[model samples]
Target: MLVNRDNPARSNMLAHMGSLQQAAYTRPIEYQEGRSHGLRGIEVKNGPLRFMSMADRALDIAQIEYRGENLTFLSKPGLNGRNQFDTNGAEAQRSIMGGLFFTCGFENICAPYVTPEGSKYPAGSYPMHGRIRTTPAEHVGSDAYWNEDGQYVLEVSGEMREAELFGENMVLRRRISSVYGTSTITVEDEVTNESFREEPLMWMYHCNFGWPLLDEGAEVVIPSRKATPRDETTAADATPWNEIGAPVDNKPESVYLHDLAADANGRSFAAVVNRRLGLGVVIEFDAADFPYFMEWKSMGSGDYVVGLEPSNSSVHGRGWHERRGDLHTIAPQATERKVVTFAVIEGDAAIDALVARRDALLAA
Candidate 1:
């Protein structure tokens, strides 16, 4: 139970409160004005962890917070409706609603590049980070229920289709859920290939942290065997990449690939924590499934954010993967599943626990 939020006895908690919203719940909401006007979503509150699950934007998350401290970065695009932008080419970035959990792919990832000609898909120019983020969802719904373990669960789910007349036919079924009295969130997704032919599939969980929670001297801890800078600029001063300083006037975006350590279950974790703020975020995933972990640090003015990206492929674009002959593709009618868990670490004790766990993983 959540102390002031809930009682020790589930019977007493239910006896006092008529609705679940008093402690943990998901409420439907619609944007009234601005760029987000007409957009529909649901507010999820599971103890100290809360966020808006955008129903129209492929069920991506925005406005993530724990204990009222903002954790995710919201770009100038704001929480605009999915209809506000094009899903292909470089145009996707113009109206990109870059909230916390931005999903990239089904087609391409990283930079925009020309894809090689497939049997059906001709040689074409793919957009930066692909077209999935702006794609609206269908069959969106939210609800709360009690599990067998006696924990209350709140969830928002929907499906998004990335398709064209003669293009790759992929559908993403996503379920984002959390339990009562917990500061953790889980995102489970199933990407199905509906096309008759095997289709290209590159996916990423662009989980971003920024601002007050990511101030000067914040640290990103990862149990990795090696870390490689994305470019020459990043390699120049890569020694201090783990400790992020204050934002600069014109600092360029630098990314690092960390070959993470995994347990027997193939699970790996990476965290960004600030002791001064008593706040932190841990992004955990299966290393065997999503083999590439990109530590993205963009300290540019007004664009400061750190992304703990867990992806199935590298930061290299689709063209690079094609050239390397390791472009991953899924068989027709097959499904690719991914489950990511995010936990908010609070207080010195919690931070210390995280460090100990990370260290154990490193030693293992």
Candidate 2:
């Protein structure tokens, strides 16, 4: 059976099925207002896992909690309760940093970049991480129903467009889903260029971790042969790239570029584990679309968090991409799809299993 968020008959049918198959009704999704940080969002609960995606913001995953404990990091001050376009440039970017996850890039550029010599941007223009995060999602919708195996599933989907009068026209259609009885959330996104001209496309999934899960002794595990620091500052502490430090008063942030080892299916995984807490979070994604994995470590007091970012381009601006000849372009009317899955691994056994998977992928 299927249920459409706007269809009353389908909704009633879903309710009837829920009564008939109570065991399959473990997934519950709710449309909430003034949720985390006073922002509107959709809350989905599946077993011991729950997540909230902000509807008023960039549709970023605002919170992810397991067993009543938040697994994701939130900014200290919290959501600003404002629209993306309400502010301009850097101010807009800083305002949306409160969420656990936010997308970057589509046009203009991701990362801080100076206008290239032949670029359309004016001279001395510095755009920090594309405007996509600040662009609110449109056509938001949610639905829940039983799958063929009688297991319930919930999904929230939306579309966001980044366009200007004579600028790039790109549309992103995103869907986040979860199945009952599981601690996993899957995100599938399709970015399309709806304009007549080809456009540069740079995107990154900024997934941040914090608090109990990111405390002392926590570590990041990835199947990579080599790691490169973003600059000399990071290179100085390169040996501890996989380790988390105790929060300090004014510790500087470090960034690294990981060349992951993927399996035969082009799939790779990374995880942040805290053995003392007996909990961890794993991110599995396709290496074809996002070949670069970046680790952002910020252990300063009141701003302690680690970001596991996967992207197609470097965190350096578009100019760097152009210089490196790694800039990706999407043709007019063409669409590109990317999929990522986030799952929680609990207990020593689960953590070991994740480690084994990474090892196996490396061995292959």
Candidate 3:
């Protein structure tokens, strides 16, 4: 067993080499067929990552630390330490802070969807949606979330199987039905533990898309006449919280409520244009589902991409509702569902097609 294939001292080297070659390309053993052995029991600590791709399926990216469990590449790093942006440096930092960059379809991190009241939630208490964690029983580190079901699913496309993130698992199961007009996938994930004592938690999608795939020439086209001013209570450009507030530099997680007083209706659409590449993508959400849309820009040196985020809550937290006298609460065992969709376009023609659709909807 310890012999090398080309060991000069071994008389059987030639024979062993031939055997190794045969083993390399021979059909896989029967046991390896169609088994969901999928990706179980593999430990990753750092560096090298395993990417699993199946025909006509979503790419399953597994980045494991050499000696540890898998890590979720969602969630943005805080603007503290290395993650913080230097005010005078490259504006891209504004976009990159908080580990939010990736080439995935888009990252969806939810829970306590937006900010809590200043006095109640505080910076220390802001509930971030995604985290690399481990359960006491398995001690295997993975992302955890409340009311999560129908989140990951193994699907068959052509000759491949993909892991997809479909919405709610029960009666309301939803998914990214189609992408780029060519592929369809469904993801399912369900977890139940007694310790998850529930409360009204925050939830929001943390999607990152970029590159020659999404580039600097890319821009966001939201169907809003005005953006709610960034809440000054916590942001650098904190200002009064109102519908008709000034045009402030937008930041991620900043609260943006519908400004009905503006010409456009609360129900607006947003699109991202990668003009140089002649590609565009549009995201549409109803104010009824996500009442706010945030345009997060990283003004410091970093990658240039736009965040067209739609949220159910304001960045000021439920407390803002209290201040405005609009706070609402959900009791135990209560579940709320939100849905958003993205469609890809090919070039200026595609952008015009989307714009035409938007105009038609508005006209109707």
The TM-score leader among the candidates is 1
TM-score of each: 0.93, 0.87, 0.46
List per-candidate RMSD values in Å.
Answer: 3.3, 4.9, 15.5
Model 1 C-alpha lDDT per residue in residues 1-364, reported as the tens digit of each score: 3323443556766888897578788998999998889988899988778899888778899778888889888776767885534555677766666567889997888888775556234666678888787678898889987766667789999999998787789999999999887888899999999989888899998888887888898899888788899889888754466888988888888889998898888888988999999989898888887988898898888888888899998997777777777888999999989999988888999999988988898888
Clash count for each candidate, listed in order shown: 0, 0, 52
Mind giving the per-residue lDDT tens digits that candidate 3 earns over 42-140? Answer: 211111222222111111221211112211222232222112232212332332222221111111132223343463422222222322110001222
Sorted on lDDT, best first, the list reads 1, 2, 3
* Regions of candidate 1 where Cα sits further than 4 Å from its true position: 1-8, 116-121
The residue-by-residue lDDT of candidate 2 on 1-364, one tens digit each, is 5533465544565676645234222232344344234455777766578777876656778788888877778876465455443345665444645445788786544455556578654354435667677666799887777655555678888898888777778999999888876888899999999999878888888889998889999989899778888888888864478888788898788888898999888889888999999999999998988877888888889888998888987876578777777678899999999999998989999988888988887787
Pairs that clash in candidate 1: none
The predicted structure with the larger lDDT, 2 or 3, is: 2
Candidate 1: clashing residue pairs, number: 0
Q: Which is the winner by TM-score between candidate 1 and candidate 2? A: 1
Query: What lDDT would candidate 2 get against the real structure?
Result: 0.76
